[model samples]
Target: MNVLVLYATVEGQTRKIAEHVAARIEGQGHMVVLGDVRDPGFAVPGTFEAIVLCAPIHMGRYPEAFVRFVTDWKTAIEAVPNALVSISLAIHSDNAEERAEAEAYPIHLQHKSGYHPASVHHAAGALKFLEYDFFKRFLMRRIAGKEGGPVDTSRDYEFTDWAALDQFIDAFAGQIAQP
Candidate 1:
């Protein structure tokens, strides 16, 4: 199977997650192509048997580039077995409402883009305090403090679950292998 893994990232965590997904899928013996949505030279739709799109949530929304890509390619994307990996710090929040809000991001994207992925995975994102500017760092620290996340802005905090992500890739591979 040929799988294309494309992503839109804010603080680069989504790109890392997309890279891991590509590696895992390749390890499963499928040919994988990884690309960024912001690039003009990404793989087009009809070439891949399966596709996985990943994006990070910032300020309660996905990046505009990602939304535009999905909107423009909705038909080709829906023609194949596709999945969405939505990365958000809210997924790591202890608050139920925050987590629910994180989950709803994808639904909102679906409504806006007219593309509904067959599978959706909500993965916890990272807090890249070291990479943020002063204003963003201050704001993120406040948000993290409220959500009971690590507030120490000296370094980064990653909340992604590798095992769960591997399981999702395995299941997706199996799905493509059938019929």
Candidate 2:
């Protein structure tokens, strides 16, 4: 299987996830390309046998650029075995409603872009407190405090579950590798 791992990131965690996904696909003996969708030269979706699109949720929605990319390439993207990696802090919330909100984000994206992915994986993102500006840091701190999440602005905190992500990649690779 030839795989394309496409991603757009606000806090950079999605890029890391996409890299891992691409590496995992390659480890499975498939050809893989990792593309930052923000790049002007990012490859089109049709060229790949499988695709994993990773996007982060900022203020409850994905970046507009990523949304537009998928909308524009919906036909080509849908033609392949596509999976979506939705990255957000809400997915790690102990609150059930918050988790549901995180899970429902992909549905919103699909409805708006008319691109129905073959699979979806919800990934917990990090609080890049050190990378955020003053306003962003303050806002994230408040959100985190409210959710009983990490509030230390001095350093970053990651909430991604690597084992689960690996399992998802293995399953995806197995499915795509089927003759």
Q: Each candidate: what lDDT?
A: 0.90, 0.90
Cα RMSD, each candidate: 1.4, 1.2
Go through the candidates in order and give the clash count of each: 0, 0
Candidate 1 lDDT by residue in tens digits, 1-179: 88999999988999999999999999888989999988938576778899999999989999999999999998898999999999998888778999899989999998999989899998998999999999999999998888777899999989998889889988988889742
**Candidate 1 similarity to native, TM-score:** 0.97
With candidate 1 superimposed using the best TM-score fit, by how many Å does residue 50's alpha carbon deviate from the native? Answer: 0.4
Model 2 has an lDDT value of 0.90
- State the TM-score for model 2: 0.97
Model 1 residue pairs with clashes: none
Candidate 2 structure quality by residue, lDDT tens digits, 37-116: 88838566878888889999999999999999999998988898889999999999999999999999999998999988
